[model samples]
Target: SDYSQEPPRHPALLVNSKEPFNAEPHRSALVTSYVTPVEFFYKRNHGPVPIVDDIDKFSVSITGLIENPKELCMKDILRLPKYAVTATLQCAGNRRTAMSKTRKVKGVGWDIAAIGNAIWGGAKLADVLELIGIPKFSYISPCGGKHVEFVSIDKCKEENGGPYKASIPLSQATNPEADILLAYEMNGETLNRDHGYPLRVIVPGVIGARSVKWLDSINIIAKECQGLFTQKDYKMFPPSVNWDNIDWSTRRPQMDFPIQSAICSLDDVNNLKPGKITIKGYAVSGGGRGIERVEVSIDGGKTWVEASKYQKAGVPYISDDESCDKWAWVLFEAEADVPESTEIVAKAVDIAGNVQPENVEVIWNLRGILNTSWHRVHVQIGR
Candidate 1:
């Protein structure tokens, strides 16, 4: 309800909505680098950003179904271990604008830029849980803790103006390899207000909703958080399911995102001089899967050419590399000769062999989430 607390954002960002601020960078800016700058990173907020001016007084309460409930302050967290991770976060509605063209869908309209990669610095949740006597990989204990719910400080209408909240399986929360973090920094700098300031949860390889911002409290619960975003929204529904016949219970909350890619070098429609053209984009998959291959087609989908993929500059991306940032995205590029007007399309295959669907119509849902359909751009060749 308070608009004065929101922080200033970059002027280049394409503002999708004013209230509950949601905006993203231009598609071309996304592929300029592997690690997205904080200023260019997509912003997705449910409500007005909460302000936490006093770092000393900020604390996150660990409660619910636990024998040793503890309140961790900034000093307590900093005393433990610190780790930095490079990960990408993509909203479920990243390509909602394109999806809505097929049929009207609910939620904010977003272009293809609602995704970004950044290096997050913070304490591991597993290590933090250990301080409370919860061992690694522990799921349901005698106290009945099966899910780890994260509650944010910001209030949103979705939860009846309650704090935005979500949860993850306790198993994932306790797994050190999962790389979940109670993050306090982004892109090597203290997190800005636009992002979760002071602290926030970072659940790598999952949908962005689970990464609650504006650190509030953590709850070890027996079931998933019954927040509106978790229970009613973000769940994938078939095209057949409409508002009148919708059954939220039929589907579970979406976690990992599907394989996705988009041609960022060009807009949805462009006019260019006929000659050698360079195409660039980004590709990523969920659950820590690496991108195996990225293909580009200039003549629609009839013929395709393998595009080069890389995560770091001058370093070719190898999906199985031990040092590779599995949770981040790879930029793909290729060169093609164009003498006539044609449609350009890009698709990717992950290490697990997951490929983007060819069309958006089949995957269309009421919420227009996870539109990982093949990305296409129509280019007019000019003399």
Candidate 2:
């Protein structure tokens, strides 16, 4: 089935699926720059892309819990105060391939490159909502609205072949720290169709799935969104639970991702010199948490050396002022002397003290959604 509507993509992308145009670049290409180039920003779509022939006519409805439930066209969006923020967007299943090594898990078998960082520009969702009038940011409004739901124009089987929708707690939606945006631009230009042109919501510090593409409508309601995506798909399960025994309701929807780091320098079967070897990778934590440091171990997890890390755009492999909020990821590198056959393991610790688990068995689940365990790579000692 021809599920995609966008034009041709870069040939270098390691395509995961063509129906929805899901693809990613190699880990080396992904970390080439602090703000990943938009062309290689790792497209992740669940359904057929909508054909928006008229960019100006693309309008989104803002209904529910508002004084004016009206339709907003592109003009309406650009008229608002625009702001740009540099952040990383990562799929919940970014490292599913690693999890599958331990046990079979269902979902896209993504490699380390399923994530990308970029500078996004748009009108703040809060400002857009205020135009229609929020009145108050109470825990629960008098009208019984406690959540803000985002609906996408794309239809998928996950919602029984209907529209894709999800929500965030109203408190979080209205929080200034949340930095939610109705984004229209990536880098310095308009967004590409594959990356949600015209308008799309950017739920910073959350999984990429929650940032629904192809603008449609939004609603403020009581209770969480009941869309299949919010209710069934992104929830995490314990390692003991299989599909047959899964109690979907018992688990909470994943909001912020866990501490994750990976070794992107050397690949399996790749030849490396016998002397001092250098390893490079990226590390990121969810919910605006900063990475304390990344540790690399040449002889497995027995001993570790802190990797040099820098979190800034415009300069690659160079450390910036360490005071910036951790909205983006930290690109890091570490060196160790190599001997015979060996494996290198890397893990990151977040500001909140969360460290990557040693392996997937401790966090494995049927879906294999969040596979943020220690990342290991094997290399051959060569001449």
| Best-matching candidate per TM-score | 1
Q: Could you list the CA RMSD of all candidates, in the order they appear?
A: 1.7, 2.6
lDDT of 2 at 146: 78
lDDT of 2 by residue, 106-224 (tens): 98879998888888899888787777777434355533357889998877767777887888887777665578888889998888888887678888779988888887998987778
Root mean square deviation (Cα) for candidate 1: 1.7
What value of lDDT does candidate 2 attain over all alpha carbons?
0.81
Clashes by residue pair, model 2: none
> All candidates' TM-scores?
0.98, 0.94
Off by over 4 Å in 2: 1-4, 135-145, 313-325
lDDT of 1 by residue, 127-246 (tens): 999998889988566333489999999999988889999999898999999999999899999999988998999999899999999978999888888889889999999989999999
